[model samples]
Target: MAETNATILIPDISGFTEFMTTTELSHSSRAIHMLIDAMLNAIGEEYEVSEIEGDAVLLIKKGPAPSKKEILGICLKIFNAFHSQRMWMQQYTICPCGACKAIINLTLKFIVHYGPLVELKVGRFVKQSGMEMIVAHRLLKNSIDSHEYLLMSEKLLKQVNDSTETADMVWGNAFEEYASIGKVGYHFALLNEARKNVPAPQAPQSYYRKDSTPYLQTTIAANFLDVYMVIMNIPGRAEWMPGLQKVEQDMPDICIGSLHHCLFENHQSTISPLLMISSDEEINYAESCRIEEMNISLVYEFVFKKVDEKSCHFSVRFMNAAELPIPEETRGILLENMQRMAEKLKLFCEK
Candidate 1:
């Protein structure tokens, strides 16, 4: 048996569960096999796929000094292949609802490292050992759990010079601890660009309605408010208000239990007032309170009048402390806080 050091590549599908749940068993099985075939074929062109570990495919290439550029290019090609298959599934497959969600809407994580390739004499078994493999496995695991689109180690990055395309594409430092791998740092890379030749999927225009009850809306809002209060330590009775107490017992129906649900669903829920308050800008006219201190409320509503057209409007209003019956001076403080919260919400929804 010949033992040598080489780069190991691992590529795993992202939305395996989504595909299995939505696709027919036979179709799902075929898709999985096809993906594996495509990956193995692409890797076979430049390296040997030593083993297929369930959903993940591992490849090894013995070197004549393979550059980081070469490794990145190979990884990109593998990603493109997966992307192509995903498009095919979306176009041809039918789901329970006559519409199929993409199974390959996943990204690949690559681990490129150099280590000793050991072969056991008792059997025809070959494996990699030492710090390189350990680092690679650790990095790969971390990347998967973090849902990173792509991840690479620092040692992997240094093999390529700054002038290289790989260096230019690296956006920013990834996980600090991973980036602090000193000679073996980790970074993320996106694969969508490499598949430019492939047609992109059309964005779905249809909207699905979840719940539209005021109680749900208020519940969602209270959840968000609690989080905000905890983070900022706002000095007020709002943290211990009876309305918030009621909402706490009943969790919000919104996704991730966020007040953003009210915005996403529009103000159709009845409990929305408990969650949010709407007032006219006229309240600010007579009040000397700063905008941040006033109790300003915002409502986000989305409506789709046509199949391809949708309108999203966010309405903001300020409530006078006189109307809420709170202290006059506290009005400006509450308004300012509400405005800040609105800004943060805008940033989150935009993304």
Candidate 2:
């Protein structure tokens, strides 16, 4: 027999009504469809979408009660996906009205609970009505008024963890809230682990210049620039060269893409290529071509020349593409994530 498990329902919209009043109905409808598709794709195959309410979508994912870590991971993935879509949309001439507003528009609310209910199938009509479902709907509505990204029963939160830290990465303030839902009381905290994970931005050791034009400096130590370039073109290699112009043009997008990939993509092992070439003969032009074809852009290259028994001089160059500009908020998020990556790399390299 299938054990009764808790369900996680997320109802969200792009706040189209507020910002998309000028848009044609057909275009707005298509945009909602795309949003739904993106949500379904991100949540995996297990969850069943219950309904669509205007621009909002309701999704139900059935599973044995998820751990707090698992719940946090799922929420992070959803937020990251929404953030990416918002950024992509901003690139277009037509703004999705106020759809891109992270403060008031681009937010999602989730309601989760355990229930002893079953879906009723009546010919072509499907029924998923239950006390739990009703509660989920009510909570979603409450979330809108509360201005909170997530709301759950104290019972659910306690089942997930005794206590969790809530670090405000965006606002730089940690907050804790307690909730009483039904007969349960639970405490909730924001997750600010990302701040601890990111390394502080460091000064580059050397700056690259092309025809008297100087670009940002590069560092041997793992920094945002290194991680941004490496993961964007992961499972590939980078070199210092004058011909790589497109890579530079797409640097901002590439950085954003890498951030999206890291936060969303689930993989068992690291995807970066090993830099093991000790001699010039080991570097093959054909292999470089194959790597580049993988869509991995090498934005910077480090030429390591041995200086002594334990030190070396590193020469670095930025790739030659047009520079892409990101919004202040997006840049802030990237910087936070970059610091986290740097800390992790520091730990790994030490070992």
Candidate 3:
């Protein structure tokens, strides 16, 4: 209703244009989508995503200004999530595709500005715009001289007091000019160095069946039992699952207590074993444990609902998704793989 204080943040993917042109179209889309999804997950539910403009996401947080520790904490979460996701991507999904392989070259940076802002609901869409928002967006195209950085407006720095400053909090001031706004001063915080020892996110929460929680659900056009059977056959999943080079069942019969080992993408690395917990005609449960960068324990749940004789609703969810950093992409990659598996299964079952 009235102008209120807000923080506008833009996390942009650097060198995306080149990534798109050089990598395979599908792979480029998947890789970029994964990275962006990871960033969005890192940002969490704290801020509102006003819009996604190309390779950048515009985030706006409106309310009383958060304290220096709070704002810095939020920034560190985003930075750690970004870094963890990137490194995890390289370690897992060891594919040779240009897009999959190109993550090593990708980098992320954020431009944040805090000031007053007003919002208007334009028809079905909520439009957020203000002088401060423009400043945040314009700051993205700056000569910061660094790719992995967090640029904060001087207005924000004023709120960060001396006690809150840590040894790694090295910031340098700069200025820029724009029409209407004139010259605006800002500071650059080296995101990587600033987040030297932030605690990584671990310990996945209990499987949230709520609408707000992160999950993937879809219906597949295939026989219900047939779909169930396909997923139940864990070893055969490598054919449809992405980055899966091999799946060997350590315990035969595929029942409760069955252990399935995995070799990812190539023979270079191995994933945690899949311990079957529940197995039924229309439902299945399993757990995957591994220590890559950090300990990872992912609980897998699958449900098959019959739509009719020829088609059915097949949904899979990954919960207890923790023990490592940035569980966002773990869920993301699993969801993506599930979608593809459903498609391939539909194609196969219909035949």
Best by TM-score: 3
Residue 246 CA displacement from its true place in model 2, Å: 32
Model 1 lDDT per residue over 1-351, tens place: 557766666777666666667766665666677777777766666887667765677677776436666777788777767767667555433221111344545545566655556644546666555556556666665633433355655665555444366765644455534443434456676655555655455532222223332211111122232223222222222233222222221332211112211111112111121121112210100111222223433232211111111212332334332334546565465445445555554443334
Error of model 2, residue 168, in angstroms: 8.0
Count of steric clashes across candidates, in order: 21, 13, 2
Scored by lDDT, model 1 comes in at: 0.46
Model 2: ten consecutive residues of lowest lDDT = 281-290
lDDT of 3 at 122: 80
List pairs with backbone clashes in candidate 3.
204-322, 295-323
TM-score of each: 0.47, 0.43, 0.55
- Compared with the true structure, what per-residue lDDT tens digits does model 3 show for residues 198-266? 354442222422223344566667767667667666678677765677877664434333456777753
Per-model RMSD to reference = 19.2, 18.8, 16.2
Off by over 4 Å in 2: 1-4, 14-23, 93-104, 143-148, 162-351
